[model samples]
Target: MGIFEFVANNIYYTVPIPVYVAVLVVLLCQVFRRIFISRRPSIMESTPLAHKTSDLSHYILKSDSCPALQVTPDTTYSWRDKPQEVPREIKPGKYFLTMNIRKLDPNDYIIFDERFLSEYRERQAIIENVGPGKIFVADPSDGGALDLCEETLVVTVDFLVTRYPSMFRKTERGVFCIDAGEEYDLVTRPWSRHPLEITCLLSGEDHILIRCCDDGTLRVAAVGLVYSLNIDWRSFIGKELGSIHKDAHVPFYESALQKSVDRYFQKLPPDKLISRANWLTQVGPELRNDNFPDKYLELVSTLPGNTITPETIVNDLYIRVERQAMRKLPSTNGVVFKFRVYATNIWDLEQEEGIPRRFADHIRGLPEPILRQKHCLECADCILKAMDFMAEQQEKEKFMNSYD
Candidate 1:
C-alpha cells in the first residue's frame, strides 16, 4: 500500500492528530498564563546590602530566595501578652513638622556610597530597569522648568564633587563628569544624568529631585531608582507632592495638613535637612519591584494558602526599612528626597533585645481598616508565621545565652 493510503486507512494515524492538537492546546494555555503573569513589571534581581550574610543568625539577614512554604494560619497565638508599642499609628503631620533640622551631614544626604561592591551592582540594576523613558520629565508648559533642571543638575553635581570628591572629576573644560566606568548615553537630560550617575556610582539609596513650582507646589521632576519595591515612578512625574499623596489611604494628606506639607517644602531653608525612617515586614528581601495590591491579589486569589508558609516566610522574609531624607538645593531651591532601603531578615531581629517584640506589638496594634488597606488579609498568615518564628527564636537565644 502507498504510505499515505496506509496511514489514512490506519486508525492509529488518527491518534497522532488528536495528540498533536492536545499538545498545542496545553502549550497555548501555558503561554497565556505566562503572558498574564509577565504583563506586570517584574522585580529586577540586584545584589543586596553588604554584611547581609555576615551573620545570618544575627539582625542582618540577606538571601535571594522566594517563598517556598505554604502559608498556614495560627489561631492559637496571643500578641497582647507582650504589649510593646510599635507599628506606630499613622499620626498625621508627625514627620513633616518644621522642627529645626540640624546642619546636614553629607553622609546622611547620600545613602549609597559607591565604595561598596554591592551598591554598584544595585546601580547597574536601576540603569537597566529605568530604560528608554526620561528619568527626569519636565512640565512642558513650564518654560522655566528647563532652567530649574539645569540649575538642579549644577547643584547636584557640585554637591557630589564637594561631598564625594574622589568619586567625581571635572574635565579640563570644567564640565563635571562622574567616575562611573561606562557612559550612560540613554539618560539624556543633565538633571537625569546627574541622579543617574549618582545611582550608578553609589549604592543603597535612591534619589528623587523635586523642583519647586512657581505656583508654590513641589513637583517630582526626576528620580534615580532601581529598588522601587512597590512604587511606580512613571505615575508621579511632574506631579505636585500634595497631589501625589491624594490617593494615599493615610490621613496625613488631609487638606489642611497637605497645605502645611506644601508650605513646609516651600519654606524649607536651604541650610537644613530632615530625615525619617519607616519599617515594614516583607515576604522577600529582593530590593527591586514588589507587586503590592494588584499582584498580591492575583497571587493570593489563585493559590492563597499555598503561596507561603512559616518555613518559606522565615526563609524568604525581610524587615524592610526606608531611611528617607529631605533637603533643599541651595541654588535651585529644589528639594531632594533621598531614600535608602535596608532589608533585614526576621531571624536577625531575634538578636536585638526588644525590636522583634516591639515591631510585632506594633503590627498587632494596627487597626483592622489600615491592616486591610495594607493587604494584610492575603499576607496575614505569613506575617503571623514570621511573628511566631521571631518570638520562638528570641526565647531560644535568650535561654541559650543565659548560660554564658
Candidate 2:
C-alpha cells in the first residue's frame, strides 16, 4: 500500500495542468470540426432543368383565327379585297395546294381549286372530248393550252361525292362541297348542261375519262363494272322444260299435256275457279271432235286418280276452263259459272232409282247450287247428257274386249 501510494502521488504531480489543457484543446478542435467546419452539400443536391417548353404557335395560326385573309406564304388576301386582286384567281398553270388548320392537330389536307395557276389569269375555258381510246381536253379559244397538273384528274362530281362522302353532301337538285373552316357554300358548276359520266378505263390511273350525257344514265357504267354478268329467265325455263321431257317416265304427249294443264292451273290466282260455260266455249268442242280424240284421251288419262268418272272429269274440266277465262278476262264484267252432272247405270237390276237421279239429288242438296239455269239445262237434262256419253264409251270398250 505504501509503495502504490507513493507512485500515484508522484505521477499525479508530474503530469502537469499544461499537458491536460493541451489534450482538452485537441479534443475541442475535433468537436468544432464535426459541428461547423467539415459539413458540406453532396453532389446530388443540384437543381434539375425542364426537358420541354410549352409552345402554342400552331394553335394560334388557324384558318378560323383570321377568317377574311388567307394566310399563304406568297400572299395574304382578305375576303373584303376585290375578287380580281385576290391571289385565289385561276391562272394558266395547273397547281394544287395543301391547307392546314390548327384545330385539326394531327393532319393537313389538300385541295385542287384552280386547273392552271398562271396562264388563264382569271377565267378559264375547258374543252373536253372523248377520243377513240383516250380523253382530250384543251382551251376552246387559244388563250393557253389547258393544264391539268394541279387539277383532280378526270374526276366527276359523282365520283368525288362517292369517294369522299363526308366532304360532299347532296342537295335537293345538286351537290356542294363542305367547308369545315368557314361558312362559304361552295358548289362546282357543271362542265356542261348534261350530266358527266366518269369511268375508269381498262388502263391504270392514267386511263380515266369523263363522258357527258343528257339523260341520267351515267350511273349505269358503274353498275356494269360492279356486276359484269347477266342472267336470262326464259333461257333457264327452256332448259328446265327440256330436262323434264328427257327424264319423263310417261308417254311424252300425255306427260306434256298433263304438265301444261297443271302448270296453267298453278299460275291461276287462288280466288277464281273454272266454270262450265267457259269450259264448253273454250275446250268442250275440242274434246268431242273426231280428229282430236287421241289428244283428248291423252289429256284425260293424265287426270288425278279421283277424277275417273265422267262427272268428275267434266267438273275438273269446267274448273280449269273457268280459271283460264278469269285470268284472260278484264276486271269489269267476267261471269263465273258453276255446273255439275251425276249419273248411274240402270241395267237389269232392281230399279230403286236411277243412279243419275240419286247423284243429281246429292248435288242439289249441297250448300251452293252446282249449276245456275243459264250455265246448265235442267239438272235431269244435264245428268242424262253425261249418261249418254258414258254409255257410248262403255259400249266401245266392251266391244273391243269381246273381239280380243
Which model scores highest in TM-score? 1
TM-score of each: 0.61, 0.14
Q: Write the per-residue lDDT of candidate 2 for residues 125-237, one digit (tens) a residue.
A: 21122221112222223111111110111122323333344444344433444532211111222222111111111001111111111331110011101011122112221
TM-score of 1: 0.61
RMSD of 2: 41.5
Highest lDDT against the true fold, candidate: 1
lDDT of 1 by residue, 1-404 (tens): 99788877985755667887899999999999989876742222111222121111111112221121112222332223323222222233223422223344543455333234455665566656665243434455544444444444444444443444444433432233344453322122222343344432433456677887778878877665666554557677777777776766554445446777777889987767677666555666676647443244556657846664334444556666667777776545777776777666667776666566666665666655455545454555666666667777777888999999
Measure candidate 1: CA RMSD: 27.1
Model 1 global lDDT (CA atoms, 0 to 1): 0.53
- What overall lDDT goes with each candidate model? 0.53, 0.26
Instruction: Please identify model 1 stretches exceeding 4 Å from their true place.
Output: 1-107, 112-115, 129-136, 165-204, 229-232, 293-297, 303-315, 372-377, 381-385, 399-403
